[model samples]
Target: MGKKTTHKFKAEVSQLLDILVHSLYTNKEIFLRELISNASDALEKARFKTQASGETDELAPEIRVTVDADAKTLTVTDTGVGMTRDELMRNIGTIAHSGTAELAKLAEQGKESLDSLIGRFGVGFYSVYMVADEVTVTTKSMDADARPIVWTSDGRTDYKLQELDEDRPHGTEITVSLKEDLASQFTNEAHLKHVVKTHSNFINFPIYVGGERVNTIQALWREPKFQIKAEQYAEFYKFLTFDSEDPFDTLHTSVDAPVQFNALMFIPRHGNDPFGLGRENRGLDLYVRRVLIEKQNKDLLPEYLGFIKGVVDTEDLPLNISRETLQDNLLMRKISSTLVKQVLDHLAKMAKDDADRYNEFWRAHGELFKAGYMDFLNKDKFAGLVRFNSSSLDDDKGLTSLADYIARAKEDQKEIYYAYGPSREALALSPHLEVFRRKHVEVLYLFEPIDEFVMDALREYEGCALVSAEHADMAKLDKFESMEKEDKPEPLSDEQKTELDKLLARMKDVLGDAVTEVKASTRLSESPVCLANPDGNVTSSMDKIMRVMSKDTSIPKKILEINPDHALIRNMLAILEKDENDPFIDQAANQLYESALLLEGYLTDPHALVGRVQDLLTKSSSWYVASGK
Candidate 1:
């Protein structure tokens, strides 16, 4: 047996102890969590030792925490790997074995904080000082020949180690003399049990608080998916997110090669902040060795997936000396990458297996998912996941994927076409989609403002360039033979074409720089006049959004396209040829341009158009009276 010995803590350890006692850990309650976690680790080490040594004695590894209000004492005992007197002196009394000397140096340099040192410095035992005035540890090594040892400290610069007189089992017990204020609450069995279940309930080993088993729920994420029942998954999801409804999607991911992690993530059916009044704090609860370390850690998933809730446990995470926060951002990014891929794969599978379910999910979260459309690395994947109302669909209830669009495209279709408007119904009524419908070409209906940005980022999908329906280059697209339209207008004769060219020139001269050009349209069917981008540049939807963002007042110049087959345009041309300078003729042409601008969403002043309509109405009434008289 060794004699009683007392020693002063190393200089760095003394400073570290000061930080732990006064400033370390945000919540004082975390001390219990840390202690329990350390006990679980010790039990795990012991179990492995028993396995390796082939010990015959049955080892029922367990952690027991007892609170005694009468004595103002809180005891945490674990049936696990115990330490010898030398180990106690080295591990607890000095900074030589504990990994906190660098932390102390960091604290000295003002680069580290007490909050940052709690979980990271391998000093979980010292956390007792946060709530305790004194701490004593009675421990006996797993070696049958070793004697029991007792260590005592007032959480100051010095500690005492002495040989224990009584014989005990191969385990460790730490007794903390709680401070006066904390003793009352901590000694209550219910409060202690709550703390145990809150943080360490998922520990593999049994945890008994006040002689009642507390860790009832196993870490289901660590279990194989086939073994877990559907009801269990639903219950787990409810527990994790606190939402009564089942998750829209569940992604269980386990990776071993790049980095070891077991993650079970759930896509929430609805966002907590439906109105988005405040930024929702969302992320996975990070766990290491089945013990909760960080809750709501946003770094585990990207911003687009903020609605995901779950647990991520990894043994390979390179935690900073304080296990409170992740040490490496690169490692976090890798984890995020893996999680995102798994989520995307799950969504893709859902899209394939059940269209209705996928559509429901899209209705709820599609807008949020658009945020990832610009991610260059995952643009292709996002494109496949995106769904939009297509001209080919009979109703707006169903949305078509890009792959479906590509698959159904005509053999000669060189580009994918899309139209942007406030809604599917509005887009279907667009003049831009006139020739597309005539040629039996499908056009995607982009409703949200972000839809344009998404399409812009996804300029091409599956080798087909995405072309806006309102662009002038669609004249070539008009040549595609259509089986749907039977009442096609005949091609204009050379003389009619010549006359149409003259009318276009006259309208262009009247409109001046307000438009780039005026031409007979091969794209329009019912509308008399519509505006288009002659340069095949920004679509009207994108133009409106950019103008709003930059607060630029200038309207983008557009090409005026007049449907030659329409009666209004034919009558305007006949009247203009007879009297090009006629006031009514000029009013008619300018009004047509304004109407096109309005349809293109470029008109800021409808008051001018209203006044022109009134003038036209008065003229028509006067003409009717003159004819009647």
Candidate 2:
């Protein structure tokens, strides 16, 4: 041992310490992850250097973590190219050159390669003091002539450095005297294992927890896409998602321009927490040069892609900057936006190139895309990636992209029409589709509630407007002429029709302003009555979402359209002619309107519906008794 010279922190370092201790980071547990990540980086660098130079006697690269529960101390040791006495003082004791500032300067100079600059910053080392009361660093550089060095700091305002005289092995060991409250975390093997697995599992070098190798999976992000085997991807998926089933799809890609990034994204076979009662999805993990920075980085991908789990490793990330408090940093924003675009493009390409695999992915996570389309309307890049089932395609029951729909549109069609309901069958049976179906116009059938909002936001695709089938003006569509030009079916004589209209006006008075209008509908073929929100004030899809969100079933008011060609309407008209005072006719008409509202997914009073059905059945029974008995 030599004389340990205690030195005060550099002015910049002392200020940085105050900020880190008081305001920089929000979560203290992040300190362990940061320190571990730094150690892993060092080990990886040493491995690479040894491979290149072939100078080291022991070429094995490994990171080992040991915990002393009784003494409340934790140590992380790595067989890496450690720092010399002078290097240790320069690297750990002072803020020599800020990594982020250097990156910015490099950007200005148009120099993009930052791979060798992984551990250049000194801030991450200080993070250990967040959880530990004292930290000791023992390091021996790869240079044979250099002496081993030991650095000590109590996380106050000063640190001490000395040259060690003991014949110690090469590499570095960091020991932390943990705070009392944080000791439990270090003592629990399970907790430490989870932290290591989450943050350092994909480190380029092996990581050992208690002398057992914990990181068995390779860092696929660092490898070439073609080099990855299927089993390797499956194992990585299992490690990332904790899923036993194989992933539906995986996108492995790297980009250098704008921002350097390496992403290995996997779409799981099933979504996270399907019932909606469990925790919200955490999105993807974020890494910087194989070190886990953010476990659940929602900013990396849109919320709709929560089903995707994988690792994104970037060497250019400013890790010292708080991701939570990141403001208008244009570089990070560009990186995030670029990543999202790349993901969307990858998905689109997959759907086009490998239809079968993309279909499987859509089956597992199509609703998430729909939800994203609605929530991230401003992200048109993602919106263009959305896919849904269309009434046009029969061979492909899976999904149809907006681009495909645009390509298949009619030559003269000005808009893309869509209808949303509970299911494909329900949408096929919808009365609103009669005119479009007859015209041979393909309508996109939306089964999810978010589809409406998606369409509303999209509004148009490739210069074509997205129009809903339920629009009142849609009834007057001239594209499809009636098959037969027979005169309109006469429901009642002119005088009688006028009298019925007057009666309906009186009924409207009784019903208050619950209806927009009562009109004879030409859109219906078999249905007696239907509701339309032509102006889309309270769209049927919106109503359904509100009901689902609120858990309420009360029906709202609507515009009722009666089909003049329907036998039920004609019979009611004749019944009123015989006796205008017949209350049964009024009840039947009201019941027909209520039934249409229900079919349209509007909220209605069930008691009123049941009472009307019971009354109608009783009337039929009485009529049968009067005629036969």
Each prediction's number of clashing residue pairs:
5, 2
Question: Per-prediction TM-score, please?
Answer: 0.91, 0.78
> Which parts of model 1 have CA positions greater than 4 angstroms off?
56-59, 96-104, 109-112, 115-120, 180-185, 188-191, 270-281, 320-322, 482-513, 621-629
> Deviation in angstroms for 465 in model 1?
1.3
1-629: candidate 2 lDDT, tens digit per residue: 78889989876566555544443234565666677777776777777777788765564777888888999998988878888888888888777665445545533433122211223453667767657788999999877787888899887799999988887767899999987878988767777888778667777777777878887877888999888898889888887777888887788889897888888888777766544842366667877777776667767776666776787777776654333332325756677777677677778788778877877777777776666655453456655667788888773366787777878866667777888877778887888887666666778888766778888777787787778878735634665565544445655678767755755664455455667777777677767777876467556787778778999866666777777667776767667667877786668767777777778766346789888899889989999999997
Clashing pairs in 1: 119-323, 120-321, 120-322, 120-323, 121-321
| TM-score of predicted structure 1 | 0.91
In terms of TM-score, which candidate is strongest?
1
**Candidate 1 displacement at residue 322 in angstroms:** 5.7
lDDT of 1 by residue, 541-602 (tens): 88788889999988788888899988787777667667767677667789998987787777
